[model samples]
Target: MMNALAKQSTVLDLIDEYDRKAAGVEDAIKAYDDACTAIEMAGTIMGTYVNPVLRGKAYVHAREMQKNLLSSGWKAIYSRLNIDMIASARDKKLFERTLADPPPLTFENAKATFGPYLENPRSHILRGLAETFAALDPAYKSHSKVKIGVKGLPKRVILSSFGDYSGTYGRDKLRDIVNALASYRGQPLMEHVEFNAISVAHRRGDDAILDGRVYVAPERYGKADEYQTLDRGLTIRLFGNGNAHVFFAPETLKDINRALAEFYGEVLPDAEEEGAKPRTGTAVSKDLQFYWSPQDVIDRALEFAGIIDLKEWRNNSPEPSRILEPSCGDGRIMDGIRARGHRAFGIEYHAGRAAEARAKGHSVLKANFLDCPAKPEYDLVVMNPPFYGRHYVKHIRHALQFLKPGGTLVSILPATAHYDHGELKGEWRDLPVGSFAEAGTNVPTGLLKIRTPSPSTQRATSW
Candidate 1:
């Protein structure tokens, strides 16, 4: 009886596996049919309805304005402006009254909706501030002399020079410069530890050696970098070893810290934790690997724009392929994709980047890719994913899930990822060093090309 039960379990597992394979085949057929139908419909509409309509009177004035209104801030303004009531300027008294006593400025008002900066707190402003801070190795983990007090309001800064690289200014002058800058901003200077003038041999190298780092906050304090107005205070000066130093005022620091904490919430570790390792350049690279996909790289990935080789998706192939970029920074990769006559949709997490992408006329969703829900409807998925530890590997795994059964996933990633995901097999080629010059780092990178399993087969187990 026990042996019979074990056999029954084995049979059930096989049956479940078979059911999954069968579903994949059905999905493949549906995707193919859908693709062919969409392409035909799009072509017909573009050639017959769209081109003629755009040149016609109906589209030239009214429809064009309606369309332009939805592009950016115009939509918000148009909605709240009460166009119907304000359209006629014939009655000066009625117009004045309407303008002066407009409907209670609702949340729909652009000014009311987006603060003075025209940026939302949650999606735009706050996220940007947090991203800036998060890019820095936590203050506690930094090898730099300054320590940030994150636990309270008006975060305190502690300064201590450990190495003897105070360049020509010397350690004493370094401290004085920092103190003077703080005073200029009307902030107090706290405990200044005695600078230990270590000899060149005794001093170990540091990662944070100042390289003229400038922290700009003109909004909170007047231009700190100007030499004439703030001559008494030093805005730019060499720290030990000629490392340049620039800092923000206490109020500015408090505001930034608050935003960072709010954006991170429980996910960010406490900033005060001792023994936390500083984020190295490599670590930071992983988070902001927004390197644009080189045209040569794009050419190679698509097999010279040959994307329809997979047997499963042959039926519904788009004339100019449909492409999805999960982290399309400034839409560079998308630009290349579109240049090839393909339709590209992008997801950019940074508000600024998303805006730039929109300005370039590419459709982009300004939201975290992980948070956005996607359909397995694209013929290709392309990206240069962030390499924060397992992040690149995970992104590849996620991208695979969004592809039509036999769609392709192309990405530029650290070579280390080749070994991370054993189950998902792909072809990889080494990209030259310094391929990411815009990102400010040169690490061994590779182009990984992965094709999803054909519908006729079971899912890739490793993915």
Candidate 2:
């Protein structure tokens, strides 16, 4: 009885194996039939037998019971996975094992591979694409050496269309692509390439209608799709070669050497040598005071409190004269203070600029406010931070902590900072100077000041 039971169990397992094999064959046949019918109806009958042949081949291999159980489903699963591994694989022979090129990395390919950015018109979808005269240059330049510099081993490139409602689409993707390009070249760096958006102008009467808003009929009337697309407001802009210039942070440039090798096969000997050094350089510097803009919040404090006159504001304190200039740019204000014969000190975050300021033989702290050591802190603080972006705010908050209780803080901030957080309050009124202006395309010249009274001193001086 026991021997019979064991035999029965083996037979049942064998039956299950045949069941799976039959099901696979049926499903494959159904799919092949559907594909063939569609192709034949469309009058494309040339490759119709290919899928059916593959289906028959799979069934033939699975005819045996042992093979069915051991190999069924698993080969299909593995072959599907092998598709991706083959495409990304460095080995050329891997394709035979995979049997196919992998599917495109669409934003909706899978939960892991697909991302939400694909839906956004502004998102940079195509990253690390090789720049071509056909793609980038309207007319191909035979030997144009003007390559967009990518720093690292770049793998993909992201491109965005100006037809976006919200403009925040491709910024992060652009950043990632730049970094990938740096990494692809066997190095680790990337350079940002910003392109300005533009609308082709139509000559209307004497004035050129620069804005491409007016979508007329007949030219687009027959095509409803084109009409909707053209009619719906779209900004004609994308990244690369544009009117709006963007700045890259230092970390962004660090990946450029790697990108160069990956994108262009040529081995850039200089990039390899440059990347090897411990202290690397980047491509960014504050444009010298040619068009220096003041921070309105800081400027307002200075204005409200009245300018601390150059004659009276000078602190000639003999007791180890101390002052702080956070985000000090080329030590302009600090130099002015020195010219007034006041022993002033400062802190600058940029290394190149800091060195420039320090070479003047004044004690300029060559450290970031956030990262600087607290020892021998400042008694007075001053700065003109980046107004276009909020990176300066982080430094501002850091500088505030460095000040002594009665320490003076002088700064120039954009007026936008006022309305941004006026209701929320703390440390804002530390100075009482204020100034404002509307047309700040050049220097706003608006200044403001605020002062926090020290309990130690009964006397008051204009900030």
Worst ten in a row by lDDT for model 2: 225-234
Error of 1 at 357 (Å): 1.0
Quick one: best TM-score, which candidate? 1
lDDT of each: 0.48, 0.38
Off by over 4 Å in 2: 1-321, 375-377, 423-453, 456-463
lDDT of 1 at 439: 51
CA RMSD, predictions in order: 28.8, 25.5
- Judged by whole-model lDDT over C-alpha atoms, candidate 2 comes out at 0.38
lDDT of 2 at 321: 35
